[model samples]
Target: MTKFISICALVTSILLLTSGRPVKTYSELYRPQFHFSPEKNWMNDPDGLVYYEGEYHLFYQYNPKGNEWGYMHWGHAVSTDLVHWKNLPIAIYPDNNSTDKVKCTAWSGSAIVDKNNVTGLQEGSYKTLLAFYTSRGCGQRLAYSNDKGRTWKKYAGNPIIPEAPGEETRDPKVFWYKPGNHWVMVLYRMPGGDKAKEGISIYSSTDLAHWTFESHITGYYECPDLFTLPLDGDSAKMKWALLGGDGSYMLGDFDGKHFTPESGKKVLDYGQNFYAAQTWSNAPDGKRIQIAWMRESKYPGMPFTGQMSFPTELSLKSTPDGPRIFRTPVSEISSLYGKKMDKTDKNIIPGLKNYNLLKGIHNECVRITGVFDVKSSNMFGITVRKSRKEAGTEISYDVKKQLLTCIGSQMPLAPVNNKIKLDILVDRASIEIFANNGEKVITDNFTPAEQADDMELWTHGGELMVDSLEVHEIKSIWRE
Candidate 1:
């Protein structure tokens, strides 16, 4: 019997050796090097972003079944530095065991740390992490987590805010309104058809379980977020900003119950891809950091369906366009910078190619900063991710037209003193351009050949002076 068992084990080992190393899946070819994406499946609209105990928790709309949108669940990930992420289990999901499965999927909402056990859901010494979400067939529901969000329990008296007839409401963004001494919720509501009114409905709650509708602000669409920013970095001059899902915002003043607009509709991003933007709750140092879903960008044959824009630090600035929002990449991104190259004060004539400007730079991932004196040239800018034959994306400024054209998308620019400054971040498949110190931002995705690693600077029609240009190779966040 012992000899027969030994022979069977030997045969199983031989078959395992012949099966060829467990078929490695999850390709990295077109995957983002820094952006957070699930290992496989669909993700969109960053939801429930909160900071707690030195960690940033990000919960996003996820379809765990496939690469397409369906059966929404809250996919979880945590980051200490916002550059590297550690994915956790699905934080919330539909109750599949229930007899009625269709009404069980969990939808978008916000999370808060119940430090004072306000909801009375605390178990033992763990501080309750309460999440408010929209459940199908139910308007709004409350869930609590005591094990640091590893598990969750839906409130027994759910559908806390019952669904109203003739109203299609979802996407509730809740926050702690300290002055009001209660929790505030900014919910999106669309009332029925043709004559339907679409806008934000404000509600207030005290214990994170019960809610009372306070007021409603119309003239906007879905995914409402309300926050305040200090104008020109002055706390005394602070103003409130109410944002919609489509990147349109209104400057206003919030008295914890109603929002009074000081300005009309204005756009935050003029790009095609940004959508469903959300800001982190309880950010450290009173920072207003935001991120948006980069929609409809081609990911080719990859397993994921969408990507998140680089996290940006938002500030209200007094520009010629009045109190406009300014966005810059988060400071934590600088930790990925590597070897650098600099070119200063060079005369670039028409039809001149500055090969040495990118002489030893052969990286697809880089951060390039350029300051150009646009006095002499009709058109001048840099081309990046080029092949040997110079096939790449061009970023140019037209002095005569007063425009900045990036791959055919033209943006009217009123340069201050005829000097244009650009900060471009190049990832494997996307480029984020910040012009005039984040006054204008354009994000676009491109597909380049595998060998397209060259770069060049060119001028058209006349001469131009390159005040300064610096390029720094960026390391992949996954390398750590």
Candidate 2:
């Protein structure tokens, strides 16, 4: 029934895109040069992230009709390097003729490769690529592709787990539980009615169509994801991490049926705009790469509304605070390195001293790595994309408060051995800062003046030591 409705919705969207007003390309006013965004539309909450057969598949919530959010559909894209993305057609759309009559939209979900033909949806000799997503008013639904995700067919028995009473559930993240030889799903559920319990619910399935409720984890919200990370890169001591839309994560133990918490909630990114993050399932060489929708801001005058954060590799480490997650840009980012500039072992003093180290850097797109000894300065940092003294973005460390400040947002960070390491990636409209080697990260969107193409280092009220500083111009992913 739901499959028939989706077919109708898909046909309608195709006709609309083909016959609608001609698509226009906005000027580079605030367009991102490297971040993943649609050619022209609104996008949010990256969905159904999976990697198979040498290609990384990305599906996201898209509003194809306008810039602002409206009728939702799954916008598709494929990438080989995670940096260069090629946009595909809309993958999943709302079922306009849904029997429930709620005017449903396709929401967030996950994808997997059924290598064993467990679902029996495979065609020819290829493993079926199955996508499990939430269809509003219809609950969880399944779609499968046999040709490496190039095309899809809605499952005949969709809404595999139909809408249950008192459960406002969505965002189904499914993974193969090797120990049990079955699939496990982590779904975000907020109980409806008077009893409001919001968290992730566990479900187990054998054939990918029939599901059985296993357990519930409390205190998390929408877009839940669960994965295991080897602590300190020790594969023998792996721990499971469960996180939600807000980037709050919990370390735990999962024995196929239930998850027992080992540590309480910890933040994944101390940023302003990272949300609805999803990791690529079945990545080559067992890499745990993740990406998130860069939300909380609007791209003024651009045809696109949102962007995606640079792909990050996730790991778990033991810190003084406890076991925490660390995220760094994937190694593939090094392929974008261009002109190099370095300033090592220099002491910077106060009183308006000017340094020409970054005089030739590309302010809009660059990667900067700096190590600073801040014992002598009250505030020390670097500013980028500065057209004037008051413009551009500032990434600073307040030695007095032991805080790392990006723009106006601040997160607590005590210096390690009286020194701080910062890795900053600057794009046309956004800045991503990884401090202390990804132990703390901040991502924010900013708009610099059109003429702002300068970078500078500054200090306040004292002197500081530059242990090492390296800046590299970043090439545009679109151009390559």
Candidate 3:
């Protein structure tokens, strides 16, 4: 009995001492919508690629010390389902502290599992997991993880790809084109004097070591990745797609040498805040699940925070207009919903003469959905904040012009504009203004300090008919 008690006490002491301070995780504070944190500190661009061995390992550009995005360690956290994540330890930190070595950040990259060393033609799987990422100051580098991805070791004399002129070239993604029977690498590259569009470099690697530069995929920017999905829900009509910097998409075809998109138009995102996208073919299920760096641009440093839309499930759905990109929140977030609010006339527009009846939020995530058929004017949305005339934020999307706008502290992390009407979600420290459902969106970060609670609805010259509305308060550690 004495020995058992002593061991238990020692274990307790070790846990208490090792655990340190409970990480003040603001991930749950963002909103009932989508919580993001590839594990604390500061996470920017999401990277690394496999969904192998059951767990979905999502890595990102994280700084373990502070909230400001720096240091550039790849923070890793796995999800059984994509939502409801638990923050894990720092996966990859900058070990090379020398001047000759590329120091600063690990930038962005992709991970591929070379199990049979198919690229080696038969080199075996001693180091099956391969990571191709951009090194700060250098060009692109490679690293391999053998025992799953728990720990990683850099390749000897790396920099598989040398520096190009505009060093802006970054984000490497490798995909196997089965028909061609070769591995292809897609990376970001910008022409020397061209500030307009960034291009995707295509490299062919037969032995995974010796890579030959082929061609450019699309004119894009920032982190660019490419994949092919069914165009009309049929493999016969497949289009090569690239996820780019400005929350856009490139849809076309890759014929061994180059990427030829049907048009230069970006396929469109689920909303405003999502960008620097990377996608991989789903492992077991084969459903293409694409995750991106949902940037909360303005409110970079606040105790409470915000994030991108949930990891999206992408598909090409045929619409009356064309083969439109259809996306919905990954199934994981659905687990966060308890009891859903029923649609009712009370949820209607011009709601009972605007009496600020605060009952429940519209959607599951403390959201508010309202439809106003405005004859004229910018009075299409509302300001749900702590007050009516204070520094509180207002979220509105002009239906006429087709743009969503957010103003104030607890706004969504997206682009703000005054163009369209929307189903806006007033998250804890964020707002997800879904314009025309998922067709358009604008997420922006706001910094309202004192009055983070309460709600208000303001209109412009004309009146807004409340089509429907809801607000969901998720069970979170940082509830307003």
Q: What lDDT score belongs to each candidate, Candidate 1 first?
A: 0.82, 0.86, 0.60
lDDT tens readout by residue for model 3, 293-380: 6576445344422254456666775655566565545655545545545333332234346444443333223555554455444544
Q: Candidate 1 clashing pairs?
A: none
lDDT of 1 by residue, 1-480 (tens): 999999999999999898775323333566777766778888888888888878888899888888887688899988898888888999987653433434667777888888899878899787888888887656788888888777888888887898887667888899988889999999888766323478899999987778999998878777788999999999999999999988899998899999999999887876667788899887999999888887775777777777788899999999977898888999998898899999899877765454346655788888899888876788887788888775888877888988877754567777777788889988777778888888888876666667688887888887777889999888877765
Q: In terms of TM-score, which candidate is stronger, 2 or 3?
A: 2
Against the true structure, candidate 1 reaches a TM-score of: 0.90
The deviation in Å at residue 38 for candidate 3 is 5.8
Best by TM-score: 2
235-312, model 2: which lDDT tens digit per residue?
999999999998999899999989999988888888889999999999998889999999976876777889999999
Ordered list by lDDT, greatest first: 2, 1, 3
- In Å, residue 135's CA in model 3 sits off its true spot by 1.9
Per-residue error (Å), model 2, residue 30: 0.9
State which candidate, 1 or 2, has the greater TM-score: 2
In model 2, which runs have C-alpha deviations exceeding 4 angstroms? 1-27, 96-102
Clashes of each: 0, 0, 36
